[model samples]
Target chain A: MIPYLIISPYIIFFLIFIAFPVLFSIFLTFNKWNIISPMQFSGFKNYIRLFQDALFFKSIYNTFIFLAINIPLQIVIALFLAEILNQKIKFRGFFRAAFFLPVVVSGVVVTILWQQLYGFDTGLLNRILVSLGFGRIGWLIDPKLAMPSIAIMATWKNVGLYIVLFLVGFQTVPKQYYEAADLEGASHWQKFFKITMPMINPTIFLVVILSTVGGFSLFIEPYILTGGGPLNSTLSAVLYIYKEGFFYYHMGYASTLGLFFALIIVSVVVIQKKFIEKEV
Target chain B: MKKTIIYTILIFGAIMFLYPFLLMITASIAPENEISKLTLLPSSISLNSYKQVFSKVPMGRAFINSLIVSSTITLGVLVFGSMVGYALSRLEFKGRNLVFYIIIFTMTLPFQITLIPQYIIMVKLGWVDTYLALIVPYLMNALGIIMFRQYFKAIPQDLIDAARIDGCGELRIIFRILWPNALPALVTVGIITFMGSWNEVLWPLIVIRDQNLMTMPQMVTLFVLGGRSEGQLGLKLASAVSLALPIAIAYMFFQKYFIQSIASTGIKG
Candidate 1:
């Protein structure tokens, strides 16, 4: 009884918020309910509708496009930044903080700030391009450019986190291994590939998973920057769910989408883990 | 030569990362006409935009609401989480392993899965547009419990036994003896929880429609997205600064612990 008392607070919250919602959401996927009415059983109607939904498919496709562009860019840029910072350098703390400043800022603020920079006209990027005699390009307004533009901003906002992760990974690589490589007259590239990359593989794997999850869960960026915009080009899975559930009040269908999204994320992560574990 | 190359790269990276913030702050204070200019320096700084932010929306109210909700949630997590942590780590009880596994599972489940149903629960309970809607659901964190459990496990069992021998209650043992030793973990979890609650937008956006009850991030988003401050670039940027400034200031002071906590705990923003 005393032990139960000790753990009651967590158990109560977990039951109400975490555990119950998960079960209730599953129940919701099989029923239709708006806030004003009582829930009614709908069998597999919601799931079937999800399969036939074009916007659902498009949102999933957009999310993958985001993941494809974002994962590599984040990895390369963060690794490069981490490597540079890991070196004996002046003002390392200042540089680290500066890079990390964006990560600490709210996503909405970052999105709004980027919206200003990516504005079609009178924006910073176009202004610089015009100064350099290049034609102005519609960043957020163009269908083809909108998703990539959002991806780039997402990378900038989040790369600071992976830099810190990679920095820690880089530091854990044994210095004596580098000494041995130097004794063997190994080139810098040779040593990095042979020693650094293999050792940091775990961190790389973690970054891949984290970024994939982050990319799929993207909401505020697209929500704020483009409002899933011009042609629904930047519409993400989570954003689609938000619109369906909140905007259209398709509670059952939205819950179905939510469940599918969670399953997709879990399966992708599991598969990635298995593949990476086999390799490692 | 290598040092010069490194410095150049670092400087460019710093510029890339820090420039938006510089732009935000300067743009907020810049004369309305000068906002679109690519200069870091505002031609003539003015408080006009900030003045507009307070008048245009419930910016001050939202800030206070955020402080109340985040601090309350943080305090609850610290107290309740440590209790659960102490029990799970120190007490030999049935279902302890089950409870621990449940927490681990909950941590892996993203909030999106629970979001709609949770909103329904909030609605049924008539919690909408209330601070209880924002704060109660978040009072206990699984990560905080897990973190505290690890911290408590490091303390020797003899101390706990000695306290028991002295007729000290479990609560007293926890608060009196164990907590003092676990200060660093408390700080780490506190900062992480505070930041998470402070910067959270999605939940508040879903739960609270009343402008007066909105968190800072939600208010800023609403103020910008609702077109309430349209074409007033300085005013828009001023709202962004209002949301970012408090956390940025806190980060500056606790930068070391902030970085350390995130890195050690593997919690992302």
Candidate 2:
């Protein structure tokens, strides 16, 4: 009946494992400490250094580039697939399951799949291009192409989850509305734009926020595929943070970068919420 | 005409989704030189790559490690998450609202932020490279608890009140009355947690260095990232396919549950 007594185990587990790490990470943000040496308090110096870090800015650029290229492509494909699946079609379950297969698979496998597909020499992408009478496109090698390549891989891995989300939203539209519009000679485009679009606008908004967050936090794809390569073109902010904290032992600086990233995510989410509120 | 167009589009897309796995399997069977050769079909079938990958890497150990770690985490989450969810939903407690909010807030903190600190904490406890490092920290998931709470709260109060008045203890009321009513939610949480633990790559990559301790995803990452010595194309594809097959099988069987389970949590605010 007592709260503390009943929930102590969960509370303790959370505090030690989750809460402690969070607070410790925050504390580490203000101090310079490698794993071996004693920590020194540096206050906002890590944050200031973060501003000067060119690689940091490049990663930020890359993260945004990933978001810009992938989000729209994913939304459009997901929305279209959702619409198609929502129709009373045959083999619906098969289609839905096939589409969602990637969501359950580990990110490593998907990354490997895409890596091999995008390989410079024996990769499927180059082979296809050469066969199609186009020259071999350097997918992961060229700095200009690396981020886009990462985005394409990301989009393939993620579109299924979004498609399912959109499908759920699409089902919420009353069938009667569509039937009524059908009687009035409304075209498919008219029905989609005039009715379905607005009805699923909220879901679209949710997907945007979720995918934007996902896009920004990307790591493994680029890490495994390019190793943040082609002069760090595919380097994501999270990957940079990972390197600073884990690889380089700049725990404090990584934390500051993380804090800045957290702030950006919060602000973007808030803006999205406000925009959604206005729409409603 | 419209139906044909839709079917064509969907079938093509399905192939795109399925193509990679098919190719990986075929490539795993094909000889190394044939990997670059322009052919969709394998010239000759051979299990030598699979044999090489399994022998060279600790494939058996990694698979078992993945199974052990993911299974333990899943069990922990199911038991603890359900208990927390039930308490948050049904138990008349003073700080229930606060606890609920706290859990929800933790969900927003990106894993990367806590990642280093968690590693540090695990290191301090001398848990690194041990299954304890992998299993202990992820035992209590905030999202799982919150979602379970949402599901459990939908159970009618009369049932609990009736159980209590029938002279049953609180624990009995939870196990007998509340839990069975919440099986759908539990299974949903279970599948998600299991898949999440199964598929998690980075944490294991960072925490566990021993090849014998590596999980499937972690092992795959090592190979994919060029950690293996041989770098044989067939062997790598075989490793990848081996990594993918079990989850793919599970996904096929639990397809419907997978959809409903994800949609229930994912679409919710």
Candidate 3:
């Protein structure tokens, strides 16, 4: 009874916040309701609408593009930085902290800063390009550049985290293997690829899946930077659902999209596990 | 030569990570002409943009609101979350494994799926525009509970046994004996909860409409994007600096702990 009493707060919270909301979210997909109006039975209308929704498909496709660009770039860069930082280097603390500064900062702040930096006419990036005598490129204004641009910004905001993850992954690879590799006259790259890579395969898998999850939930960068603009090229899956629910107040349809998006995320993670976490 | 190459690459990477922030900070103060200039060093400094943002928006009110909300949620999670966490770890009870599994399951589920229903719940309860909407739903975090439970399990059970023999209540045992020893877990969970609460925009944006109740993240996003900054790039940047400044200072002081804790938790995630 004492234990039950102690744990009851969390149990009650889970019931109300987690358990109930989860069930309600699924139930909401079958009803048509705005916040101000009574919910009416919709009978697969919301799900049918999602199936034919072109913008919704574009949003998911944009997220895929973002994942394609972001996950690989982020992992390579983070792995590289982590390898360098893991070595006995000078001011490693300062270097890690510098790289991680953006992660700790607010995403909205980072997005707004990137918006200025990505500005075609007056942003820092294009200005530097013009100063270097290159053509000014639209970082966020062109539909072709917008999602890729956002993926770059998202990578910048989050790569610090994966760097730290890889740093820990490096420590777990025993030093004895490196010493043996050195004795066997293996090249540095060979040692890294052979000994280090296989040892940290799990970390690689973890980073990939984490990056995928992060990529799918992309919102603040696109929301603040372009507002899913440049012909809706940067419209993220989460942001689209947000607009559906809050902007248009289509609660039922929004729930349907969200349910479908969760399924996609879970399935992707499962597939990623199968592919990346292979038995070495 | 090898060290030089490594240093060069790292310095370049550091610059890539750090330059935009330097530009933003300097540009926010760079007397309007220098605002758009692609330079780290501002020739002349001005505070007019910061002044403008402050005067136009309820910056002070938002700061207070964020402080109230973040600190309240942090404190609540520390107290209640640790209580449940301690029970799960130490106390023998029915449905213990069930509670633990439920938490693990819930944490993996994305908040997006629950976003609509949570908002609808808020609306139905007339909690929209109130602090309750922000504070109550996230009053306890699963991560914090899990962290606490893990920390508790690592402790020798004899500590709790001795406390029990001394007639210490389970509540007293957690609050006095165990919690004091769980400083690292406490700090990790505290920083994660506080930073997460501080940095979030989506949840607050959905649940809060009143400008007076806006958290720092929501306030800055809306202030800039809502056209209240009125096309002044410096002012927009200034609004952002307010949001970034607290984190920058916190990170500066606690860099080691910041990296260790966030990194350790990243692996488990």
Candidate 4:
């Protein structure tokens, strides 16, 4: 009774918000709703429509492209920064904090800030390029440039987090492994690949899955910066769902997409775990 | 010999990380014509954008709303999360593992799955456009419970045992004996909860329609994209800075706590 008493609020919230929404969301996939109108049964239409939805496929593809670019970029950069900062260094704490500054602010703030920076003619990047004897690059305007630009910004926003994670992982590793490597006349890259990499496999796996899941839910950046535009190039799966649900009020279809998106994410994480967790 | 290379690389990386923020601050303060210039240093500093943002928009209201929402949610999580966490950690009760497993499960469930249905829940309850819409659904965090549970488990059973022997009830034990010792966990969870609530955009954008009731991020997003800040680069940057600078400054001072929160929650991810 005492235990239940303490957890009752959570139990209530979980029932209403978590458990109910999950189950209700499934019910919603089979029905049509737009909130203002009555929910009409829609059967398998939403799922069937999803299979043929080019924009939906593009959104998912764009998200994967982001993950492909972001996760590796983030991991490599984070690991490098962590490797250097983990050693005896001046202002290590300050350096770590500097990289982490953007992580603390609102994503909207970061997205809006980068929107200004990624602006075509007025952007700092293009301005710098023109000044440096290079043609102006369309960081966000070009459909080809848009998703990758968002990916870079996403990496910038989140890599600090992975750096801290890798740092934590680095600390757990025994110094003797590196000491023995030094005695064996190992090169820098060799020690990192042999000693550091294998030891932090769990952290590596964790970073991959975190990035994958975070990548799957990319919204605010594209939502604010692009409106999933310039040929829907920046359309994220979650953003697509949001537009379908709120913007167009396609509640049932949005619910279907949400469920499908969640399924894709879970399967990916599970497969990723099986692939990586086994080695550990 | 190798130290110079590492230091130089680190300095370059630090500049890359901090450079945008310098421009944002400068652009927000720069006169209108200089706002679009790529220079980090503005030719002149003026508070015209800041003045416009305050007098013409409800920036202060959104800031206050964000403060009220974030702090309230944080306080709620600390109290409720700690209670349940302590109970699960200390109390021997039926269905304890069931409760713990549910939290672990909830931690894995993405918010997207719950997004539409939860909005429907809010709509059904007429919670849309209200503080209840903002605060109630997110008042308790599953991760906070897990953090507190893990933190509480590290305490010796004897401390709890002694507390019980001293006639401290479960609530008293958690609040008095346990909570003070759980300061680090408290701060970490508080930051996570507050930041999540503070930085939340999707739910607020979905639920909040009124500008006066908007959180800073939501209001700022609307203000920027809603054409109010059109061609007003200084004004837009000012609003972004207003939305960001407080939390960013806070992060600089207590970065350990902020970083610890992310590191701990990274395990959730």
Candidate 5:
């Protein structure tokens, strides 16, 4: 009875915040109504329409573009920097803090900062390029370049998290393993591939899955930077849902997209668990 | 030679990481035309942009609103999330394992899955356009609970047993003994939760319409990106600075604690 008294508040909070909303959202997927009106029964129409939605496909394509460029580059850069900093450098603590600085900054600030950096006319990137005689290039304005530009920004903002992760993973690899490899006359490259690679495989796998989910859920960056502009080239799945639900008031359609997005995450996560987990 | 090369690389990477922020401060002071010119440093410094943001945008009020909501929510996580985590970890209640498993399973569910339902609930409860809408639903974080549970499980059982043997209540054992031993874990969760709430923009954008209730991030989103001044670069840049500067100052001060907190979370991804 005493324990129940203590735990009841938490149980109540969780039910209100977590359990209730989850079950309600599933029910919402089957209804056809704007949030303002009486919800009408519309069995599977929203889900059916999703198959033929061109914008949905485009958003999916854009999302994959983000993940493809960001995850590998981020992981590789983080590993390199982590390895370099791990070598007992002067100001190692300062470098670590500097590398991790971007992680603590809010997503909104990062997006704003990047938008300025990638500004077509006044952007530092183009200014440097033109000064180098590479000529000015349109970054956010060109449809082809917009999503990749967003990916670059995403990588810059988030690579810090993975750097810290890789650093932690690097520390956990006992020094004796590397010492034994050194006695075998293994090159540094060989030691990294043969010894370090397998040991940190789990961390790498986790980063990939995280970057994938985060990639698909791209919202604030594109919304703030591009507004899904230049022919919707940068429009992401979550941004699309925001438009459908909030901008267009298509609650039923947005809920359907949400369900499908959840399915994709669940399936991909399961596949990763089955295949990637075994290899690592 | 290797050490020289490593220092060079570290210096280069640090510059790359810091350049955007440097340019942000510079451009926030740059004349509107110079904004598009790509100058690395400002020709002059002015507090005009900061003044413009504070006068035009409800920045002060928004900052206060954000402070209240995030602090309240952090306290809720520390007090409530710990109790729940303690019960799950140490108590022999029915459904204990099942409850733990369910919480872990829920973490995998994307926010979109419950976006609509949560919105409707907020609407039904008359919470829209209120701080409660922003803070109440997010009061219990799945990650916070899990982090606490992991830390609690690591505590030597003898402490809890000794507390029990002394005839102290279970709540006292948790609050007095377990919590004191768990300060690191609490700080870790506290910092992350506070940061998450402070930076959250989406729900606030939808739920808080009145200018007085808007959080800092949400307010900046509307003003800077909304093309409010016929594309005034100076004004927008100033607003962006206002949005970022407080958080940046906080980060600079508490960076050591912040990094340690993130490292301790052992976030898988």
Candidate 6:
């Protein structure tokens, strides 16, 4: 009885918040209901509509583009920063905190700040470029550049967490392996590729999976910066869901999108897990 | 020369990370005309933006609301999470593995999957635009439970056994014996929960419609989104600063713990 009492808070909240929501959302995927009206049973319609939805496909494509740009950029940059910070260097703590500063700030604030930075005429980046005798680019306004610009901001905002992850991974690599590599006259590049890379492969895999999941759920960045603007170039899966539910009041369709998005995320994560487990 | 090169790179990276914040602060304080100036430093300092933010919105109310919501959720998670963590790790209880697996499952599921339904539930409960809407649904974090369980598993069984021998009740044992030893884990969960709730915008945007009841991040975003502060770049930046200032200050003090918590828990998603 005492044990149950102790654990009851979590159980009750879980049932209400976590468990119920999961089951109810699955149920909601098949029903047509806005916030105001009665739920109408529409079997398979939402899913079928989702399949036929061009904007849904576009959002998926845009998300893939974001992942293509973000995941590689995040990995390389985080790995580089982590390697440097892992070395015996001055002000290591300061540098780590500096990199991590943006991660702790609100995503909305970061998006707003980047909105100004990405502004065309009087923005910081363009100011520097024009001074360097280069033409200004419409970062968030241009369809070609919008998603990548948001990707850059997303990378800046999130790479700190990955750097910390990689740093922790670096610490776990046994020093004896490095010492043995030194004894064998292995070059720095050879040692890194052979020893460091293999040892930290699990962490790399984790980062890949994490960044993939994050890239798909891109919302606040595009929501605030572009409003899914410039021909929906910055539209993301989550943003699409948000718009469908909140703006259009199509809660049923939004729930369907949410459910499908969840399935995609889970399947992608599971596939990555299996692939990484087999390889590493 | 190699050392110099490394230092230069590290310094440059630090600047890249820190420069936007510096820009935010300078822009927040810059005179209206100079808000968009392409300079590192503001030409003149003014508190007019800060004044405007306070006057235009219930910035103080939002800050207080955030504080109330974050602290309540943090406290709830820490206490309830530790209870579950202790039971799952130390106590011999029925359905232990099931509960643990449920937590792991919940952790894997993205918040979006449950978001619409959760909002509906909140609506059903008439929690919208109230503090309960912001607070209750977040009271128990699955990640917190997982983290606490991992931390509690490391604690030696002998200590718990010894406490039980002393006639301490299970709750007493948790609060008195195991919790002190789990300070690092406690701090980790506490900071993470507090930061998450403080910076949470999406849920609040969905559930909270009242201006006075809005969390700082939600309020700031709405303020900017409404185009009310359009062309008033300093005021907009000032609102951003107001939203960010508390977390930034907390981070400065708890920098080590923040990094330690994030690295150890790996809960960011």
List per-model TM-scores for chain B: 0.97, 0.93, 0.96, 0.96, 0.91, 0.96
Q: State interface RMSD in Å for all models.
A: 1.1, 2.0, 1.4, 1.4, 1.9, 1.2
Residue-level lDDT tens digits of model 2 in A90-143 = 998888888888777777888877878898887888988988999988999999
Worst 10 contiguous positions by lDDT, candidate 2 chain B: B260-269
True contacts kept of each: 0.67, 0.61, 0.86, 0.82, 0.62, 0.78
- Which whole-number lDDT from 0 to 100 does residue B108 have in model 3? 86
Alpha-carbon RMSD, candidate 6? 1.4
lDDT of 6 by residue, A86-194 (tens): 8899789999999998888989889989988898888889988999999999998889899999988989998999899999998899999999999999987788779
Worst 10 residues of 5 chain B by lDDT: B260-269
Candidate lDDT scores, in order, read 0.88, 0.83, 0.88, 0.88, 0.82, 0.87
What C-alpha root-mean-square deviation, in Å, does candidate 5 show against the real structure?
2.0
What TM-score number comes out for model 6? 0.97
Local error of candidate 4 at residue A148 (angstroms): 0.8
lDDT of 4 at A62: 95
Q: Which stretches of candidate 1 lie above 4 Å from their native place?
A: none
- For model 4 the TM-score comes to 0.97
Per-residue alpha-carbon lDDT of candidate 4 for residues A57-100, written as tens digits (9 for 90 to 100): 89889998899899899999999999999889989988998888
**Candidate 1 chain B weakest ten by summed lDDT:** B260-269
DockQ of each: 0.76, 0.63, 0.78, 0.76, 0.64, 0.78
What value does the TM-score of chain B take for model 5? 0.91
Model 1 TM? 0.98
TM-score of each: 0.98, 0.96, 0.98, 0.97, 0.95, 0.97
lDDT of 3 at B204: 90
In CAPRI terms, model 4 is classed as: medium
Q: After superposition, how far is residue A198 of candidate 1 from its true place, in Å?
A: 0.5
